[model samples]
Target: MASAFELTRNMTIGQYIPTDSAVHRFDPRFKLVAFGVLVLAIAFCNTYVGNLFALAFCLALFPLIRIPVGYGVSGIKPAVPFIIIIALLQFFFSGSIAPGGTLHFEYGVIRITGDSIRLVIVSAMRFVEVIFLSSVLTFSTSTTDLTRGMECLLSPLEKVKFPVHAFALVLTIAIRFVPTFAMEMEKLMKAQASRGAEFGSGEWWRIIRRTKDMFPLIIPLFNLALTRAEDLILAMESRGYVPGEERSVYTRYRSKGADWGLLGISLALAAVILWLP
Candidate 1:
């Protein structure tokens, strides 16, 4: 998961919070579809009011989902710097200026054009909008359900010799291991902590020095993962598990009328966003 967001930063995809809320009970397909539409709306929303509407809507629904607001909000922390950088770049390179307006500078070589600044603000809004929405989806949904939903959705691709099932299997495997990887990282941290790794060292050089001291921990963690993977393969082989084997899925998902309605509404929203003035 390699995310910098502390809320979700310490975990992997497989470790999404378990809940019995409506967010969890709803068909996985419905949730995924709703997420896609919401993200598209945020991305294409062109005005401040639109962005505000998104924030308000999220605020209203987040509580209903029974998810901790702090967790969802904190998951976006990792992207803040990226969003800021994009906005700055857009501001300078927008190439939009007025005939009689004066340029101003705050940082080096910063020529402030009205249009450029506006675009930058818009870009920031879009960035925040996307990250926050994505965080909400991830925080509210389990990786297992998401992978299963994808496999089901793409099953039609199997008709063209696409190995759709295999693709889904790989995706499921990758997502299922995210939390395991994070736990491994935490183990490595604890191992180094016992050896006096001063993580709080303020200086970048000191931080580097401390991290360098943990090389022994990383090596073991990597070795452990490889060993575990080999063991997993052996265990599966003993159980007669074969790749590309057709089997009944215990956690099958079915789309219902509500799901169809959600999809319809999503498409309508997409159409409206694409046609916005």
Candidate 2:
């Protein structure tokens, strides 16, 4: 249980790291736009060379933001099994191999071809690139900045009667609760374990039993979440935070020349990746 708690605590998603680096100092709005463009570019990349460039770009951001490469890379470890499953499905079942292509292997109904292999490789690279790039964004930006930046970016939608501020608040609260809930789960698991509830005990039958046993943890966690939500509502109401009312931020973000330069460079790199032959 302690090991489980430590593992959950080490997860970096939805958590921010403070650093005095240019990437961390950049305006969140700019970072949001740049990240969107980079993700789109990565998604569209099909060739090995383009994917290599995308991978290189993602790796380079770690040092720029003063984050350890291993730490950034560890963020993808949790998804590796899923990624491998998807890649294998794509490789064996995609049916994308060119006519008359060299076949690598074949079974009763499954086939492996050069084109399928290439597609799987590129898809895997894209998955890693997207996940690591997103991790960089969350690692460098704080929850407040993310909320404000999203609100500012979505403010233009207010002309169409959209509740931009409310949407931003909800998004922010939801993201902020991710780590909180993870910790809560860890605590609940520890408490249960103290009562002789074994988890991941390595016996197949015990593992199956533990799976059923965990269902009891869900109701308590949900109730705890609801309690927290109520507390937040009361706190906000006590502070006179009315929805749709004009409110000023304590720290206003202003874009500088450096911000623009960074955006420009990101855009240029995205263009180059898209235009690569």
Candidate 3:
């Protein structure tokens, strides 16, 4: 019964799988930089061939990083319905972008064309690429690594009075708390189910009923999250931790040749993919 509400099973974004492959060994700073470059390239890519190449590059990283392809992609399963709806909307009302392209179908205001098809396909591919890259990043890097990496990457912003340290800490905490919240929700679901609360036990097509059933779990989850956050705040305050303060690092990262090579390869790949016809 609890298995039905197990979010962590398919939630791979915030979860780390310590495979200790070369990808994991790369300096987090380099990894973050590479990730940013690839992300920007993918975002601007609107062509079918470009997106296909980008997606292929992203998919190939799973094997290189030693993460199971199935597990890495399983996280997107829950988002399929939402993605489908958005794709349909884009496909139907895409006349603006497809004005000069080949027209495929027209029904009053709704129009489908070559450009529309390209848009939908490219958008979906970009989404999958981003998800895959993100999953790979989190799967290889730990919360500590992510925080330190982000802080280092954004450190220059501190010269202009930006709260880089605090921002990095907050971001890392938000990510780290995802799996925590999932586990908490699982526990809450099980508790509620023990007390005769129905959850995830209805016809698949009954969306309204399913949503209503989930309402009972939402409030408790929020309360639990708030409580945990408050406790974290108290603990941090007790430890004399000051936000935006110059913190001493116990682990200073030194990038290796391979790390530089990895970043170079990523940049080259992004450039090539974006240049694809």
Maximum-lDDT candidate = 3
What lDDT does model 1 reach? 0.65
Q: Evaluate residue 242 in candidate 1 and report its C-alpha lDDT on the 0 to 100 scale.
A: 86
lDDT of 2 by residue, 77-182 (tens): 5566567778879888766557778888888668888988888999999999988887788889998899999999999999999999999989988877876777
Provide the lDDT at 163 for model 3: 90
Model 2 earns a TM-score of 0.84
Residue 12, model 2: lDDT of: 60
Sum up the clashes in candidate 3: 0
lDDT of each structure? 0.65, 0.84, 0.86
- Stretches of candidate 1 above 4 Å error? 1-14, 84-112, 203-239, 264-277
Q: 1 or 3: which has the higher TM-score?
A: 3
Candidate 1 vs 2: which has more TM-score:
2
Candidate 3 ranges with C-alpha deviation above 4 Å: 1-3, 97-99, 195-198, 201-209
Evaluated with TM-score, which candidate comes out highest?
A: 3
Residue 24 accuracy (lDDT) in model 3:
90
Which residue pairs clash in candidate 1? 12-178, 12-179
> Across residues 114-146, which tens digit of lDDT does each residue of candidate 3 receive?
888888888888888888988889999999999
